[model samples]
Target: MNTLDLHAEEFRQQGFTVFRSVLPPDQVKLMRNLAEGRYRACVADPPDRDTLRGGVSLMRAFEFGTAFRDVLALEPVIQVVEALLGDDCHVISQNVLRTPTGRGIVNWHIDDALFFPFFADLNIDPKHVPVYSLNVMIALSDVPTDAFGPTQVAPGSHLSGRRPERSPDLPAGWEPVSLRAQTGDCYLVNSQTWHRGAQNETGRTRYVLTTAYGRRFISQRFYPFINYTMPPHVLSGAGSRIERLLGAHDKGPYG
Candidate 1:
């Protein structure tokens, strides 16, 4: 198997894996500028700031700029995501996180409600674990140390099938791993994995472009749940892969 396949297997077994130098330094700068600009705009516009959770971020940020939209299609990141969740995987959510000095997603928690919860006494095969969704984090800034507040994941936590909050106990032989990366690195994570951003004290902002992918059976979370339309300009010259990533889907099972 090649490096990406190994990385995919690592993602399956360890709950996450990082791909180094996925984007060029210049491209990282461009995306970082776009993200910071979006954050600043959100700050001025009270409505946009509402997406800011424990960390500074904007949900569905790809809708605003082509640079952000381009991020969703970066091949290195998609390779691992598609390998784990299948090629039919499409974007479930695309958001950006920017944490400056003294601020980060300090709370350790799962991304959402447990997707495949099981009992402590249940015997399960690690290979049988299903991946329903994915989290691909594209780091536009360097996260070389704990002080930079890189993401931390419990190795194999997804298979534990227990929320860190409720269980708080590691499955035997599991340990926490801090996902530190250089600028332009991309990391693939199972959404079920227990994770959180470590505190940032580097006096510089940590910029991460986050994209979530789900299997064909899962629905795209474009929000509003009613009549949200993808802005035409964003898809002005996109190809088939980007369109699919942007929620363009052919008929699938149970449709």
Candidate 2:
């Protein structure tokens, strides 16, 4: 069987899987340069402190850049999310990470909590809230196994049903596994999985782009940066209907 078939099975069992060369190396490099240029330009101006809050606006508007729309069109990443989430699944949240060399690590955490905030008070069934169906992280640069930390995750943690609390040390049963890869590698993780960004001490910028998709019935948080002034071509292949649903500029019934 092909990689997609293998990845699909792995996702079902482990709740996540990594695909090597999901995007062509040349394309990944081009997109990375385009995105980095936009980020640098934005940072050249006074920084917006709120942008660091780990919100959708911060990730999509500032980091992903217009070229990211092209990346979203990649067959492997798109097909995997669509296969897992069903055809109507839209881009709920797109992210870009620009970790400067030698950055400190972030706390271990779960991605779904950002959407399903009431986990602590789920007087009702937790299933009612939209948990992330799939989370895709695409590496735009090489993440060496030895340096410039990549994402660390606990394999099969999605089955736990309970989110792990923050701790300086790993709990007794959990093992920290790093998701390292070269440019064009993509990691598809279930929203239920536990993961975190490892620190980058290698003196090189670590860049990655990501998108979270949910079933069609769910709402999209933030997408299609309001500051994006480019024309349709920038997001052309994303399809008008899908773009409207996934993007913020639309004013139709979904809007």
Candidate 3:
């Protein structure tokens, strides 16, 4: 079988998969430059402590640069997302996450809690519900060691049907796996997977771009329809794929 088939199978079994060098050098350079500039700016004029996540994250990156919008529409990344979430998927959030040396750990948890308000009344088991969301993470810098604060995931934990407990007190039989990859690599992660960002102990910084995608039926996590609008330039030049990913074509009947 081919790489796509392998990745699909891996995702089905492990809740995540990695594709190495999916982003070309030029694209990597562009994202890296944008992230570096933004990181410096955030350091100079920091946001509120709660919004900053202890000085480790930057949200809504697609609003900051056209390059990030392009990253969201990359064919390889979309192919995997579509394989897992179907063609009706659209991006829900885009963020650039940076872990500086000595930054503390991000506790292990699942990403589905935010959606609880929408799905709580269904009264269905999570494992039975089709996975409607996934995170596509692009590595902007090498994360080949634990010191760089690589993300740690518990394999096959999504099958548990509930969020895994904290790292040091995981349920019986589960184990954390440190995800190590080089620049330009991308990981497709199921939002249900139990994962956390390790502390950055090395002097080097760890940079990652994360784009979260979900079925069109799911409400966006970051941007609300009542007040948010896409930039005019983005609306004009974006292709159909970008348009769908941006939720331009998923309007309700009343709107």
Best candidate (score: TM-score): 1
Judged by TM-score relative to the true structure, which candidate is superior, 1 or 3? 1
Q: Estimate each model's TM-score.
A: 0.90, 0.77, 0.85
Q: Give the alpha-carbon lDDT of every model.
A: 0.80, 0.66, 0.77
Model 1 ranges with Cα > 4 A deviation: 47-55, 166-174
After superposition, the stretches of candidate 3 with alpha carbons farther than 4 Å from their true spots are 43-54, 114-129, 167-169, 223-226, 250-255
Q: In candidate 3, what are the lDDT values of residues 76-161, reduced to their tens digit? A: 76787887788878998888888788774567888866334344344544335467798898888898888788888888766665
Output the lDDT of residue 92, model 1: 88
Question: Could you say which candidate leads in lDDT?
Answer: 1
Q: What are the clash counts of all predictions, listed in order?
A: 0, 1, 0
Better of 1 and 2 by lDDT: 1
Q: At residue 189, what lDDT does model 1 achieve?
A: 85
Selected candidate, larger lDDT, 2 vs 3: 3
lDDT against true structure, model 1: 0.80
Q: Ten residues in a row with the worst lDDT in model 3? A: 46-55
- Ranking of all predicted structures according to lDDT, beginning with the best and ending with the worst: 1, 3, 2
lDDT string, candidate 2, 105-159, tens digits: 4576676554444444445432233334777888888988747778888886666
